[model samples]
Target chain A: MPPTAALSIRDLKFRYPPGADDAPAESGEGVGGWIVDIPAFDLARGEQALLTAGSGAGKSTLLSLIAGLLDPDPSHGAGTIEVAGTNLLALHGAARDLFRGRSIGMIFQTFNLLHGFSALENVMAALMFSAIPPREHRARALALLERLGIARPNADPDRLSVGQQQRVAVARAVACGPALVLADEPTASLDPENSANAMDLIQSVCRESGAALLCVSHDPSMAERFTRRVGLRELSAAPAAVGG
Target chain B: MAMTDFQIVVRSLTARRFSTVTTIITVAVAVALMLTLLGMKDAARRAFDRGSGNMHLVVSRDASPLVAILNSVFYANPPRAPLSYAQFRQLRDELPVEWAIPTQQGDSFRGLPVTATEPEFFTRLRPDPDREWRFAVGRVFRADFEVVVGAGAARQTGLRVGDQIYVTHGTGTVAALAESAGARVGEGAAIAHIHKEFPFTIVGILEPTGGPHDRVLFVNLHSSWIMHAHDRRLASDPSVKTTGAADVTDADRLITAVLLRLLTRPGQDVTAVEPVVFDQLRRAGGFTVAKPAQEIQRLFAIVGGIHQIFVGMAGVVLLSSGIAIMLALHNSMEQRRRQIAVLRVLGASRGRVFGLMVTESAVIGLLGALAGVGVAVVGQQVVASIMRGQLGLVIEPTVVPAILLGVVAATVALAAVAGLVPGVMAYRTSVLRSLKPLG
Candidate 1:
């Protein structure tokens, strides 16, 4: 099966703040910030992979790239890329959105559940964006939350503990049962006890959904649970290579 | 996105309770104002048209509007310069007229009978030719001594049939006519036969025409002639002779004005010759001529102008409300940008995303306008009592659908403007960044 690469990235480079010297005399966004460069990256289906690098290494970029967040790596300096048999490089704006909506589920390091919705509402809202039938949304959302061990559907994250919020976020990602789940620092805020619960809940949910997992984190200890571990340096070059 | 669109809209509105209600109420108030103004205009038009029922010509060399309306049409006051009865007779023989019931005024019940004339003087003065009036009770005046009471006269005086009352010999009396119990026409005032000194019975009552006829008392032409003949009747008989009916033998006798009639044809019938003939007759009779239809059109213009003023005022209100909707929509754009971005990334097409914002705005505006009309209807009804009672202005809250159409169309258009801004904003944001955490 050639390891079923769920996401394949080619050489990509980008300038973050549009241009270096375009900043005017003094409205102060502090002149220029940084740049990101990447050679190649790939993630296989149903496999668990971890990304470890320092703070500014763009570890998050790799997850964004695999999840189809950033545009299809426009530089073409790398090579052809594929995800789940669909060529990522050959998609346009609308097609890319549909492709991502159907094939990828993303979990941010920080839980970005809507402030206006309850935990169940937040999960249900994610289902709304999909092409799923509206009548089927409730059942799919509740079942996914139940599988991830969300005991109460009405609880908003503000009322929940840090570990519980991550469960809701994870539940949302796999709510529609996608082919791949990408998490960025899923257990970063947890203590030892909460961390273990979050890791178990997220990894188990992704596996149960039959999705490959790509979790990005700087902490090396979190790698023990995954089948594979690769540093930003090992993927390509240090500092010059960016994952986010 | 489907027929469930309304359901989604309703649920979405209910979900955000206060904002939805306020917006709806705003639109409703505007519609209400427009509706009320339209209804009032209809009422005013009805009243004016009624007051000027066709009495087309006032015959004079030159007559003012007040003189033409009152003396010639209404028969309220006597003509200032009375041509000899011989002159009125001469004109009648010459003109082509539908009908002219000669009229006399300026006498009173004690204080009320400012109108003095024969009963048939009004028979030919039909307001609506199809529906002529007759007495509702008692009998019409048959003798010189008998008097027929109009509905207004009956109601105001508490008068009935078989009652005897006398007219006070004066104009514009200050005291109540009934206060003088002996000679004053009181509760028992009856229809008297003209040309007689003896009392007769009040035979019948006229139907309410919502006009000046309501205030009249009827007598035969002989009664006024007999009153004028009082000087000749003194030695002949101390008691006035009561002739129950007109001395049909004297149909060709003297009258203060002439009564004439010409045949009227139905449908597309132009009586252009009548006006010219009427003009020649007025010149021959030493008077002037006026056409009732032309006079009615003039009245209508005045009424129409007043209605236009009110509608214009309501339009101003509608305009401000439209501007208000636009402002509200524009203000919501920045806050709604994230929502738009999220919808687009959710596989919503650009048009679909734009449509949502626009639809919401339209919903708000349309609801408001419809609600405004409802408010106006109830408001008009509330004030209807005062309107009818004080000014005789009938205010009917007619359900005019065209007005509602205007409200819906105008408000929806405004709401679209509201939606346009946010849609553009959503179209501009980066979909990828919208999914990103706000760092």
Candidate 2:
């Protein structure tokens, strides 16, 4: 009762279908049949955790699973993934999409900002699926971009510098004011200084919004900034890492 | 504010402006071609129908009924054979006809066909039902050498009321006749095979009737007879210096065709007794009795195959454009997988993605079809001008709004159907795989 868990995972198991080599596997985990086998995991509300893993360690795959982009392989085992006190696995189709969009925000290393959209528009796109009134979307998006030190919210994301683009992506992720935020190697493409700045911006934004943060990275140095740290090898019961 | 689905579709199309515009133009060209063919065909049929006028039957010595109507009603060609004055009298007396007007052709003024008939021809004949022939200037020819010019003829030749014009013997242009005859007469060498001795004064100009009649010059039958008799006299003895109307006798009087309106019972449709009169005239023999309406229908039936072939060709073009739309969108899908995946990741359902693709295609088609309608309208004027100049057949601008709307709606539906393949490609896009950065 002290603190509600923003994201709770229990007895989660996922395996790639045989010959499903669409994505590169790390450490021969997909070939060995169990990419993810976690017994239990939880992040308290407003908590920030850094999950470190080597390359191809299924870090992105785990992020995808929590975001409802990919489903856990139920053939191996049934699992429960609860986000904001709602069972994410129970939702289907558009309901699942709405739940993910409203309750979770994700940032990628590549800064997956929608092309052909301005920085403000990328953030507004997140709010499009939220419960927020459409009339207030523009002002909210502009305020968020300004808060992130984006001088020109109308500028195309592609025209922005690498550091600025990441900040824009960070804005998009938290635009909906989701309860939980996920980062899959969010600073992998940045220089050391830019990476530190991106991490600081993301963490500060999450703290301001009272949102929990789970950032996955192969870089060992990322653990120094987080009060909570978990290793992929310790979290996943797979014989090897998901891919690396 | 969040952009609507329509706004998103528009933005996506604008991002690939080259392909979108190319596809729209391809669709526009196909729609224009199809609508133009349809419009011209409808106009031609109406012109033919209007040319028939109120005539129940056209009796001529042509080979067939359709030929008789074309030569007598449309002036498609000058009549080769002439019916004697005695035969015209006999037909007027014996046939169950209300008004029998005899018309003689084979004369021309400045390349326009010249038709000579009685004054009753102007008063009794109508260019269209419920529309009487109205004079634009002066009055109908009442004297022997007086003439009435049609609206189109007056405009083309610049002949006005009281202007004198020498009528030529054949349908050839003055230049062509001069080139053939090597004879130069008149101030500008304008006299070529023209019966210069008998200069007819234009006494009247008729308003446009929107039919082949608009391009004709009308003269009295007595004037034509007198001119021909003088030609015969001059041919017999090249020294014959003068000839007058007194030289024309009953033996020399001839007319090419007789336009007949049958005597119908009170309140009875002219078509009701048309077949009976047609059968009776055919049985008597010696003359071609053609119902102008029936002949027009037959002409349409004969040309219907060619019309269908053109329509089929246009449909093929439309189908090819649809395929172009499909290929254009499908090819773009290959490069747009990541974008589609991103949309899905942003909470756009698969159905939403599918709908977006189809809506984009339909928008392109709607725009293209609207543009095509505009092109067809301008194209119709050019086509109508050509037909008027070359065939002397006036084509009314016949762009029916219902037909246009139907074509536009069909094109949009066709484009939507074309988009289905690409929409499916987008719907099946994997968010997880596509989110990975491409090498």
Candidate 3:
């Protein structure tokens, strides 16, 4: 663990509960065996780290934990989970949502955008969730979308190509000016050219916000683009073989 | 998302305008029926309450309760039987009469008249409690042939004091006296004999009593005797040339029916007694006498029962309407589940959501209740207009507290009941259900 890292995880442990007598994630691993033990990892500011994992390699689980959607400890599960000085897990029910809104941004591997909202609206909603004064939200959101190369600000996310949807997702992720941005397979659905465009937009925005970017994917081309890459198998137990 | 409760409810209601309007109309019909019947009942109650005995009519059971009271007391219908003048006097002495003035009705004059009643009919029996008899234009009647006029009678007939209104035969006519040579003799000459249509003065004009006496002309019972004395001595009076007052006076002993108020109970009074008692004691024929309250109470009971039944039926109708509203809300919930979940994620508390739906129903109830009251008032006016024209019933419309409370309570209760289904649905919704995409 580096002292200069924006986020440092040391022996960060978790399990689903009652069913797991021993840590489900332990690979006969470190001191005090536990599931989901992150022996070590560091994401310095302004750096993008790609996670490479095959199916069932805990890529999504890691993304969820980092996003604060899941808890790290059973007893203190309801309390805020801190990143930098802000706590996403402990912000009380509604305020946790608000803190996530203001401090952390997420892009799903599925590219989940509210179906009813336009690309601009999808992005604008993210900014509105932040503690920023409402009057400043629209202007800030439009500027963020355009900067992310979302050419059509008023188009519905569906009307846009996959590339455009990815850009809109990126626009939403950075619209709040978050300190941490988590993108799970951010350009997985895009063609090679649009994927390049999407990747360029995400990388530049993370650098500008000085937000530590943790992007997960098993694609060779995408994983090598990150400042540091990690394999999920290096952390979790061996992937279960089907028909076991 | 930041909207106040009222604003949200208004938006939601407007969004489902058809459903909301249906709910309100349902409540309106239910409440309107209850309000209208209750209003009519209130009016009828006031009429019975104000018109009952409170003041009573003491009558002989000629036919119906309505008939007997109307005829005897209004003096508009003919008396059933004649109780002799002597008999009337005897009973008046016996009964604990506040005032017992006899009436002789059923004999009208086209212009000339004969009233076979005591002078007290004009003096004491005119129903007004205040303003005892005083002549508006002239002195009160003094002689048997003299007369006193009610205010309306004087106005319509145009006969003033000293205007000799000739007496007429009791045959209800206006022809000059042609049977003059019979048993009866005129005091003066042809001028005095207008049959029983003799000349008499209008000695008094009675102030209005809002009673039958208001249109009557009053005269002493003796005047009727002199006019009808021909009928009494028919054996001799049929041949006018031989007829005389001796035959008329000696043969006639009876007069018209007596109007009596009891002075004392039958077992208690002294001397020879009066033959008729209008109120309590048995009359000339031991007729069935009814206390006005008992008769009136029964009438009110029938009317009020019908009224209560209508209101109760209205309550059932309202209950159905409430169920309709509850179903509408329940049906909409499947669609609304996601929206509510969104609101939960966006920070609406469980209590707030519950309160919001309840408040919407309350608004509907308030509006329906107000509309029902307005409808009731208009309905009352319509009934009153009809009654005034056709029935001569002056029913005062009343707003009884119980009726108002019942209508208002029904509206609110129905709405509150309607809200319950939706409130529970909203309360049980979860964050996972809301945050997840719809199927």
Give per-model TM-scores. 0.69, 0.92, 0.52
| 2 versus 3: better DockQ goes to | 2
Q: Which ten residues in a row have the lowest lDDT in candidate 3 chain B?
A: B185-194
> Residue pairs in steric clash, candidate 2?
A25-A243, A26-A243, A26-A244, A27-A243, A27-A244, A56-A244
Best by DockQ: 2
Give candidate 1's chain B TM-score: 0.63
True contacts kept of each: 0.13, 0.44, 0.01
**Per-candidate RMSD vs. true structure?**
7.9, 3.7, 13.1
For residues B1-439, what per-residue lDDT tens digits would candidate 2 score against the true structure? Answer: 6767887788789888999999999999889888988888889999988887778889999998889998888887777889998889888898788789999998887788999999988898888766889999999999999999989989998998989988887665653474356454334223447777888999999999988898999999999999888877876798987777789988669999999988877755364666787888889888898988888899999898899999899889988888999999999986787888877777788888899999998998988898889888888899999888777789996887777888889899999999999999888888877878411
lDDT of 3 by residue, A1-244 (tens): 3444555554456555554322223223233434355655666766677777665445665565665545666653343234655544445555555566676777654466645467776666666556777777777777888777777787878898777788787877887777778777776667788777777888888888888787876567885577577776565443221101
Give model 3's docking category: incorrect
- Tell me the TM-score of model 2: 0.92
